[model samples]
Target: MAFNNARIDAVPTLCASCEGRKKGICSALDCEQLVELAKASRKSTAESGATLLGETEGIDRYANILSGVVKLTKTLPDGRQQIVGLQFALDFLGRPYCSESPLNAEAATEVVLCSFTREAFERMMQESPALERRLYRQALDELDEARDWMVTLGRKTATEKIASLLLLFARHAEPPEKTGRHFARFELPLSRADMADFLGLTIETVSRQLTRLRNEKIITIENNRLVIVSDLRRLKARAGNS
Candidate 1:
């Protein structure tokens, strides 16, 4: 079938279920524009550890994360790997005009995405100035975040790094409510090994820091995955947050 002729009628329903629709790139689109865009898109789910894109591969599609977390990693020819970034719900997952992926994006937890073919997405961007503006804003936001993380990786101690990571997850998982309370309870999306990769530390060091936090009564672990923070202020102090 011709790519343009493959339009489906399910796009509106799909957009209705997407949490990212209101906050992501699609937010710039009106109802009519959204339905039109959706006609050229589809919904997909990836299991934990599934690769959404590989380094140096052609960019076939762009995706907006609907749920769960994705880890972006870069590797050297010598087999060294580093976790470069993490994408959460409502985050866009691909470079718009770029032809190839610069890094690998893998699901750190099971994830659902709204997938749009690159050609269709680009065409929409050209037609909708609002969409283009929205994408540009997102690009700038991502650049700012990357700069902040570079500082964290370069200057923070291992303990401080772990604490910072935990605080990031807490903020992402449950944003503070209007009640002005700061406690958070959520599962750690990345495994210990993944956390080590993200934090530029060894797995043993990550484990040790987690233990120290628990010992200090800063955080409580209900299981291997779940974490509860009773005093966010203390956690932030441990993270070296001024």
Candidate 2:
């Protein structure tokens, strides 16, 4: 009975059953603080392809993604765009203390956000050192991911890039098993064009690499979206992680 109660505590009554609360920065707050924060938050949803924040958009709020995927793009004035990053459930979105967004954030799939005014969040951070520490750690994690992805984009081959993208989605689908020996399934958040853009490959290169992986018995594609990774060990090995 005690273990069951502890399990139930994952969904404390102070807020909706958001994974963000369990794994996100909200975990830094106690129940009373959660209630206070809730008073200033509003739940909102964005459809796929909706722009959550545009480049240079005035930043007024911060959000914790509750579900689905958000893609970040870096763009040029000439209309060229590169998909720079992706965010998933329980990830914090938006830059606090910044007046403008440096990248465009768009929904790659339907998304839910628990968002509150930046003023309210800043006040909470000032009052709670724990929250400030949590935000700092989240920012550090983002920096590390960005560095790793830079290697993937700059050094990985076409096949390696495709496998790396699939491996990323697989890890996001569930905590990656040791050596990734376990199977995983997830529908891709981005289309072929978006994947190409994100991986710095052409659409034809992405498609050809996917075909190679399929023929090699590493993964299977269905309905042009659903992906089942069977050979995760091989897939990870091919992802060029050394």
Against the true structure, what is each candidate's TM-score? 0.90, 0.90
lDDT of each: 0.88, 0.87
RMSD of each: 3.8, 5.5
Per-residue lDDT, model 1, residue 147, is: 90
After superposition, candidate 1 runs with Cα above 4 Å error: 1-11, 175-180
Q: Candidate 1: what lDDT?
A: 0.88
Q: Write the per-residue lDDT of candidate 2 for residues 88-177, one digit (tens) a residue.
A: 998889988899999899999999998988888989999999999999998899899899998888888999999999999988885444
The residue ranges of model 2 lying beyond 4 angstroms of the native Cα positions read 1-16, 174-181
Candidate 2: C-alpha lDDT: 0.87
